[model samples]
Target: MVPNVRSSLPVTGTKPRTSWPRKALLILGFLFALAAIALVAMAVSQNKPLPKNIKYGIVLDAGSSHTNLYVYEWPAEKENDTGVVHQVEVCKVEGLGISGYSQDTEKAGLSLQHCMKRAQEVVPEQQHRETPVYLGATAGMRLLSLQNRSMADRVLSAVEKTLRSSPFNFQGARVISGQEEGAYGWITINYLLGNFKQAFSAFYFVMNFLNLTTEKSPVPLDKATSAVESFCSRPWHEVKAEFPKIKEKYLSEYCFSGTYILSLLENGYGFTMEKWQNIQFLGKIGSSDAGWTLGYMLNLTNMIPAEKPPTRPLSHASYVGLMVFCSLVLVAVLLLSWLTFHKPKCLQKGLI
Candidate 1:
């Protein structure tokens, strides 16, 4: 017997099948993709380099051991925040600190001339008249003040005369207490760490206002090794009861400096030894030194205002990320719509 064959014809009575919903979806997807592209273009156009108007300040750190002159610069518009001012150059005066010239107090002022001349060279001439210069004599001067008030005053007067004679604006020259030194140093480190934005509580204010913490934090040890091993492994009371002994052989002066720092952190600031271990001591953070000089400059420039400035708009990185994420979502939607609307065509090609 021959194989039977049958022919099938389209049913003309029924309307041709149409998927309006699928077509609509595809049109919406395309429109969404176009909108995403437009948004990306708009964001790209708006992304421009921030205007960089640079400003400068000068500070002479007249310390007990020695004197150092520092030049700092920041964006003119951002002077009201922390970690913005950076030390561009530092000139260390030759010979002893200003206190060494107690007998010949006039020489104390002359000692700073070398560094001031260098400052003139470092900063622009136009900014010289407007740039304020400050002199903060540290522990050495403080001791002199206690020993002989008149001599200390004479030393400050001499330095003030020298600074006034210079082309720059002389703000003032005076001895800063050890407590202020420590507190300012703390501010410098915390600012560099960018911790101010994350935590600003009563403790922060108390530490800032009352404590004399320095910025020269020790390099960050592995937290697990330091805080966890030392504190977590032992009871808090036990750790607090006994202080760790220092065995490393460093400069003899470090003994005094270390004790002074510990006293400042504990007695001066009311921080526990365990809390001290948590603190990081760094010589330099990024490109700037972790010293009180930066804090001093910031104070003069009003970089750290009492009231926080208006919150800034979204950052550049966030803006870029948002654009990219939107673009990806739009592409995915477009692909899904294409697949859905063309199912029949895929089926005809034996692809579905």
Candidate 2:
């Protein structure tokens, strides 16, 4: 039995299993390489501006004093976001506002033709069919509706007909409510200033402070602020009476417009009197005009998305730079590891 034992012994050639730590390191290295490649690709992609698909839209601010046609152009990619729309061109109609044509209601529609034609000139021909044109009559139309419903209807009908006849997609012409006009105006102003959400946060902060504080002095910061806001929210008539230096260059209907604005902030939107001081009543905020035209265009085309867009944790350039640095470190480590573990014994002895 002993004679055959040596010859019958099995010949084996099996590789040893990799240790858990070694396997983990290998996997981590592979992932690092993959991440570096991905970062590089992302950097390259971001470095080049993507082809912009330009979109066009038109909004007619049918205010009491005048009608203004604003042509807005934005990248199609950013259509579903706020503050992306910019007023490319503004065409002011020579005649009175749409409501001014109450007697000759047909002329109200005709007045918009020139503006719409100008819009066509500014917007590309291809976009005309797709471009939506909306007409939002302001205080003038609202007053007209209240005073003479038939005249207001006729004016709106006239404007709608004119818009429909044009090459652009005609949404409709209607008298926007005082609350909507005011709210949209607020949105426009805050959106332009990039303070829409910030304003709301400030309001909440003030409310919390009021709730938390036990001080009941009438002259407290919050009370003083509320008084100032109340003054601002007062109708223009009261303002003019209180401060005689306040001049009216435009139509004398500031009282009506201001009243509606106050209503919008106080009653419609439930903003307390204290918040009125924060709102801008002027025509312009910096270089841009603070009005509802921009907001209207943004809303009509669904430019503002309901959900916030996802943002990358790291910028493309930073990610790529980090990856590159890590890759170099990894290469150096690997080189050092090879030298430490795989160098020939004669070479190691000679180096020592």
Candidate 3:
């Protein structure tokens, strides 16, 4: 009678025990959630894009008129890619071109000190040893070699000595061929204009010879002839007044330069009037001068690869996202399986 009364009365002192399976399910869910969180953290940390590793290069364009020091830089990862390399700085060496220092061969090297120092300042001190510095003498040095091979050698030696003394890795100092100059100029213009990867037609004419007097007149290409003729006919005082900022020496050569360029384009290169319209009189393309310097550096450094680099089918983010999605689906499947296998006995009995 006492036991029957106790069974009928409410259990006051004791609480119902939690099922082991239910506790296990809760712990598994917490663990799976923590695992998912960890997977997400790992994906984010491991797949993030790395910082850019920039590489520097130096090229000295020792032209007939003047010497130009060009500092170029590109990402180390994209060295083989096109349109990535660009000019960062251009320092003009004062006085004259290296060939002009033939009288005092030692001064040819000394003249480069200012620009080389500027390059040192532009590039990091640490990179100096790794940065390759190249000096390519163009028409001036070529002419010097033709006139006097021994003098050209001495001039080159002097400049080489100076470059070797610097912190940079001196590649070489020598006179490049006209064929090389023309080819490199073409490469520079097209490269800077992004023409390598697309369909385009263009021509680049270097007016290096225009500083001297030319017997040929401007060819009739569009308004080029008229413009040059009109400018040349103007009074010297008027010309000076119009271009006050231009140095007298350079201003005086404009007429000759215009005429020589037109003649070269039409006669030397054999371009018709129609083709002349397509010619791009570009001094620069996006801060980079349209010249042989960049092309020269690119060739020596092997920055431009002949073949395209391999690429991944999926982007980094897409790959990571897909992994996370698959992980979540797996977690959901496991949760459903646990629920199906560990259903309450009452519910299972009701189904039966």
Clashes of each: 11, 0, 0
The candidate that achieves the highest lDDT relative to the unseen native structure: 3
Assess each prediction's global lDDT (C-alpha) against the native. 0.69, 0.68, 0.75
Instruction: Write candidate 1's Cα lDDT for 142-200 as tens digits.
Output: 99999999999999999999999999988899899877887777677667777753211
lDDT of 3 by residue, 43-156 (tens): 776666755566788999998778999999876656445436779999999988999899999999999999999999999898899888988999789999999999999999
Best by TM-score: 3
Q: Which of the two candidates, 1 or 2, achieves a greater TM-score against the reference?
A: 1
Q: Rank candidates, TM-score, best first.
A: 3, 1, 2
Q: Which residue ranges in model 2 land beyond 4 Å of their true spot? A: 1-50, 79-83, 197-281, 303-352
What tens-digit string does per-residue lDDT give for candidate 2 at 121-237?
A: 999898789888888998789999999998899889888888999999887788888778767766776777777762311122223322322223212444534544654467777
Better of 2 and 3 by lDDT: 3
- Write the candidate numbers in order of decreasing lDDT: 3, 1, 2
**What residue pairs clash in candidate 2, if any at all?**
none
**Where does candidate 1 stray beyond 4 Å?**
1-51, 79-83, 197-279, 303-352
Question: What's the lDDT of the predicted structure labeled candidate 1?
Answer: 0.69
**Candidate 1, position 21, lDDT:** 63
